[model samples]
Target: MLKIQEIREIIKLIDQSSINEFTFEQDGSKIKMKKQSQEVETVVRNVVAAPPVEVVSTQPQPVPTQQPVQEASAPKTEETKADTSNLHKITSPMVGTFYAASSPEAGNYVSVGSKVTNDTVVCIVEAMKLFNEIEAEVKGEIVEILAENGQLVEYGQPLFLVKPE
Candidate 1:
């Protein structure tokens, strides 16, 4: 196993150099680091699972009784659905937490009515501590943002709707 100081030095050297990826293996342990051209860096590690915990809720749940209200909104829902039926969906490439911006202080990459090109980065998805940038694959204006910031998204789930130009 590499000592703490040695590991720190290796990380410093990798950061100073232009290498995109570095890997080292000794015995049964492995270490890998990857640097993104967009300034994202990820350190991959093995994770161990902990025992599960059981929780019991005692709070009473409220029952919903809004059938009439739902019926009244059905037509409006259908109309809204029909309007977006022609828009293209930008689906997630992997399961991860969706982020509207690179950082909390940063502005959102895209919002409703925002224009995007094929290579435009629309959002960031974080899975296993690695932040993956998701791009807009079509040239269009964003019609909707389906996922909320920090919300967990599943693979192939639609994240945005875009009206193609």
Candidate 2:
């Protein structure tokens, strides 16, 4: 069971974090919370326009033509998505700070191109002062490291992309 102070602390931390939802259960007690999404409306108002320029020429002037402006498209991540579609994604089990190494003085547990077994410890996620070791869960070579050391990671966020054997 969690005390009121502990619950309040958790709520404050969650409110300052990017986590959209969080759930915890222990000792037959459960707590779930979700943040409401807020949409911001932006209004642009100004009475400003360049006055039309008047040009006088003796020779016939070429007709001024307006070219269509192409809207910029969003960057494509589909290629990368397709490439990793067959890979196994290792995700964080709980919201916490992700650490690539056990400590600042220690080397990283795993890196890109590192091979790992299902039981291999890949990283650590610290939550509520508890350091939880995360495992690969699948035998594969790490193709990508998604989270940075000391970065706040949300529950179920992808921490690594592995190419399964």
Candidate 3:
């Protein structure tokens, strides 16, 4: 488990560093963190593994006992439904690896709450060994960032959410 202080430190580093993406692997766990650009939108994929269960009885359980299990799964279904409609997506113009900054040593083009105009260079998508600058098509304030830096982004994949100004 990550400590609160460590998480805070990570956030601070992200705020201060020019690099937009960072990944760390420790113990048996891995974490990838990225700062999104103002004009781009991103999609987050979460895969949760089911917890291990111990069987106390070899016999089949009664129908009545399964009622609680069915009820518990309902919340997960509702959460998925809630997330479906709450997004404003910014899609990629090409297939490539999404980058928030020009390079690992450079500052990111944008961050959450950043303002952008129609011509703002929001991010760089590397395709066929070439770096392509992605621009915002509309003026807005960045509300959410969707993709992680250095991650493979498909064509038309969302990169950011912008609240129109």
Error of 3 at 113 (Å): 0.4
| TM-score to true structure, per model | 0.55, 0.59, 0.49
Query: Which window of 10 residues has the lowest lDDT sum in candidate 3?
Result: 55-64
Q: Give candidate 3 misplaced runs (Cα > 4 Å).
A: 1-88
The superposed Cα distance between candidate 2 and the true structure at residue 148, in angstroms, equals 1.2
Candidate 1, residue 61: how far the Cα is off, in Å: 15
Candidate 1's C-alpha lDDT? Answer: 0.76
Error of 2 at 154 (Å): 1.1
lDDT of each: 0.76, 0.76, 0.67
Query: How large is the C-alpha RMSD of every model relative to the true structure?
Result: 14.5, 19.3, 17.9
Where model 1 places Cα greater than 4 Å from the true spot, the runs are 1-76
lDDT string for model 1 (1-165, tens) is 677687666665555444568887775445676665444243434333544332221222233244463464356667788988889999999877799999999999999999999999999999768999999999999998988798778899999999999
Pull out the clashing pairs in model 3: 40-159, 40-160, 41-158, 41-159, 41-160, 42-146, 42-147, 42-159, 42-160
Expressed as tens digits, the lDDT of each residue in 75-147 for candidate 2 is: 5478966887999999999989999999999999999999999999999999989999999999999998988
Model 3 whole-model lDDT (C-alpha atoms): 0.67
